[model samples]
Target: MYRSLLLGLAGNSAAEALALRYGMRLGASRFVAGTTLGEALAAVKALNGKGIAVTLDHLGEGIRHLDEADGYMGAYLSLLQAMNREAVNGNVSLKPTQMGLALDPVSALDRIRAIVREAELHSLFVRLDMENSPYTTATIELVRQLHREGFSRVGTVIQAYLYRSAVDVKRLTVERINLRLVKGAYKESSSIAFAKRDDVDSNFKRLIKIRLDSGVYTGIATHDETIIDWTRSYAHRRSIPRSAYEFQMLYGIRTPLQESLAREGYTVRCYVPYGERWYPYFVRRLAERPANAAFVLRNMGRRE
Candidate 1:
């Protein structure tokens, strides 16, 4: 129900206006560091200087124009070069739909190849942001093809909510695919995904255990304390080192926890998103934890 409502509003002009108004005030503190590359660079630099790694995301999804996504790919390549020069322990994250996959997968893949080539120059990595079910197959295919082309620096995300995530994990393991596993953020159908949080978390633990066993450099992306603690304990019992994999969390969702984890000898990467098309991302974040929206509204008047 909530997912349907959000997908419905994703195209609403008026809802976008309202979201923008609320977002402009709340985004600063909630998650988005800025709408520009320079601002993102500063944010990543500050975090990396403190020994905290980062994953910089050029936030805009469900793109309609091939030209727009082409431009997005170019921007990401540029950012990759900057992060290399800045030595910011960071990489770029991207959405296929935002990269012309919605317009044309061929063009999107071509553009992604260019971006990945640029990343290769800097020895930086790219995390292909997974979207809703509609694009999951194409996203996986793109990542697999890129890996085949020797772009090992690129990775993709898998959502535990999906029934096929375990299958995907197994396939990725067979192919030596690096993955970042997240508890599905988008509301999905019970037929296709775990509807309850507990079910999803249970699936998450299973996947984490499998990834750890595979010795693949999987990213455990979650803010749930239980998942984190379980990962820590399982790693310990299995004799998995902290450096074997990494921890990733969305920016602003768990700021202190990210830093704390980094300080505790874990590789922590903050998912820093930026760009003008932050409406859907912002709205979903609100829906995930209504308290976040309330907190944003309650403190919209404060200075950063």
Candidate 2:
């Protein structure tokens, strides 16, 4: 119930306004690097210093206008340039909607293509983030189109909670597209998603195994120690090299665990997000773990 409530608030514009006014003082700073690209780059540098890679996200989505989407594309292009100039060991992730997929699919594709082209020039990878169920098909299609157009440096995420992910994973694997396997954070319907945590975790493990066995590089994005342990054991038993996959975790969620995995000589990447439109991303982070809400509330009175 708590998780659902937070997810619901993720789209509440009035609540978002309040959050913007308060900025990171409401404890969003723990999750969001900052509201600027420079801050995000610094965070990336710090993570790189710790032997951890990063995938930076300029957090904005649910655009109502094409102009907004263009602005987002501009920001991404700038982000790509900055990442290259700074020589940071990181890539980029973006939501399809943020590029106008919902408002105008064609224009959205062009915008995303531009960003991907820019990223390719820097030899950086771009992970098209999977949104809710409504946009899942379109997001995957966009990725397919990009790959066909020679944007081989691009990839997309897969949510294990979804019933269709297995098929999507197999097909994308056959295409040799890299993927970041996540348990998903959206409030999806039971008809199309696994509602029970056990079911989701079980499916997550299944998907991880499928990708690992395919001998394709995968990003196992999760914070569950159990799942992490299972992945480690399975990979070891299968004789999969550490280079075959990397463990991905959200920023500020499990610092010690991320570093521990890195210290163990395993590749670990942090999903570091920034930008002014952080309320939605912040709420989703809270929804993923209600304990995070409690922590945020407890620290709400404190100043950044």
Candidate 3:
């Protein structure tokens, strides 16, 4: 049922209907910055003013077809150019399939190389976001190739909930890859992933300690207060300097926690996504928190 909601939002017309029906403002708050490049940049400026860094993500996944994938790659190249001209205090994140991975491996990797070269020219970073487990190996392969090409500015994500991520973390150290650790948001098989929340949290801290000790640039991406507290205690116990790593969170999800981390002098980056294609993104947020869905429903009547 939740997957259906996400798929529905990915459809442009369905997303429009849902947005209007829900009385949502739909101006790139959590889902995206905006459809226009100017709007996206303006949104970035606003966040930078608050001392919160941003990451530009062209909202998309699952290519329409090979031709469409090509078009998407062209658009990303243009976005990279704009990012260079804008020179904003943020980097770009991309999903491989969106760059043509689904069409063909060679096609996707080449396009990714183009984007990475663009980021390199501008001295920017590119974050390869991890999707479902099916794409994990392919994504890692692409990252490995890219890193071999000397793109330290490139990084990929891992889900701690995956029973195998502990080994993956060590593998990442082989390339000295920067990683964003998240509780696997996608539902997967218990054979491959931990369904219980406690187990996921435990693995998260364990991986955090190892990564910090390994001296890799790690991103602890979660809003769980307990994990945040544990991270603090662990860092303090090891007397690890604050520059060792940073905490990352989704925008519009944990305002208070983000601020608290910043006030304590920790580097906190808010994942700010912006684009007209925000429906799939918003639906995922709602599914993550049914209470948020209920809140939106309560305001439905006001929009009517």
For model 1, which pairs clash? none
**Order the candidates by lDDT, highest first — what do you get?**
2, 1, 3
Q: Write the per-residue lDDT of candidate 2 for residues 35-123, one digit (tens) a residue.
A: 99889888999999999999999999988888899899999999999999999898999999999998989999999999999999999
| Candidate 1 vs candidate 2, TM-score winner | 2
lDDT for every model? 0.85, 0.94, 0.80
Q: How many steric overlaps are in each model, in order? A: 0, 0, 3
lDDT string, candidate 1, 131-163, tens digits: 999889999999999999888988899999999
Candidate 1 accuracy as lDDT:
0.85
Name the candidate that leads on TM-score. 2
Query: Candidate 3, overall lDDT?
Result: 0.80
- What candidate 3 gets wrong by more than 4 Å, as runs, is 1-30
- Model 1, position 177, has a per-residue lDDT of 86
Top lDDT: which candidate number? Answer: 2
lDDT of 3 by residue, 132-158 (tens): 798998998899999888888899999
Query: Model 1 — TM-score against the truth?
Result: 0.95
Q: Which stretches of candidate 1 lie over 4 Å from their true place?
A: 1-8, 27-29, 300-304
